[model samples]
Target: MTGNTHIVGGIAASLAYAQFTNHDPIIMLAAGVVGALLPDICHTGSKIGRKLPLLAKLVNKLFGHRTFTHSLLFLVMMAAILNAFMPFEAVTAGILVGMVSHYLLDMATKNGIKLLFPIKLTVRLPITTKTGSKVETIVFSALTLLSFYFGYEAFRFYL
Candidate 1:
């Protein structure tokens, strides 16, 4: 999925998470956006990768794309890291939602991610679509609409 789609997914995930918790919606959304793009740091051509070339290149060299960062282990490690530093449970949950949303979206692709990494267990949806294709466009659009709807719902107090 493109960065924009990931962003939409992140926003939707954050909003959904907030519905069950009292965390500040804006902060959760920000963290969610970060989490959404965090997986792509392993790809040198990704949105975050372009901003941090050295780190991206090193990650690409060490783990390759859709392998390590996309793994469940990596997600667990991220949760641990956030738990250690972040005081808010809701914040941590928001971040995890974003990361999980990214993985779910990636699962819709043909190559799919190695969810278990070294274990090489690939998990994907039965049907998949090519990245940046018409199908992806449809997915993006739908996710975008969902994001907007959820965003409004979450921030209705402020609006």
Candidate 2:
């Protein structure tokens, strides 16, 4: 999946979560975006990678793309690190949800991801598509619509 699709997936997941949780939407939205992009740090060509080239390169060299960074172990490590800096439990939940969303989106791609790393096993959805194919564009559009729907459902309580 492309960065934009992952972003929309993040937003959609975050907003849906906001509907049930009491966390601030703005904060959750921001965290969601960050978390969604964080897994792609191993890819130097990724949106987040472009912004932090040195870190991306280092990670890529250390673990290669889609290996450790996209694994459950990485998620646990991220949760621990995020908890140290972000005292708010909601923020951590939002970010982790977004990261999960990222993994799910990538599973739809042909390349798949190492969701259980260190085991060298690649996981993917039964139906997969090319990264930027028409199917991905459709998925992106659907996620966008879901984002809007979830946003409206979540924020309606405030209005």
Question: Could you say which candidate leads in lDDT?
Answer: 2
- lDDT string for model 2 (28-145, tens) is 8888988899899999999999999999999999999998989999999999998999898878988998999999999998999999998899999999999999999999999999
- TM-score (C-alpha, index-matched) for candidate 2: 0.96
Error of 1 at 36 (Å): 0.4
TM-scores of all predicted structures: 0.95, 0.96
Question: lDDT value for candidate 2?
Answer: 0.92
- Candidate 1 wrongly placed segments (more than 4 Å): none
Provide the lDDT at 28 for model 1: 86
lDDT of 1 at 125: 94
Task: Tell me, by TM-score, which candidate is best.
Answer: 2
- Stretches off by above 4 angstroms in model 2 are none
lDDT of each: 0.89, 0.92
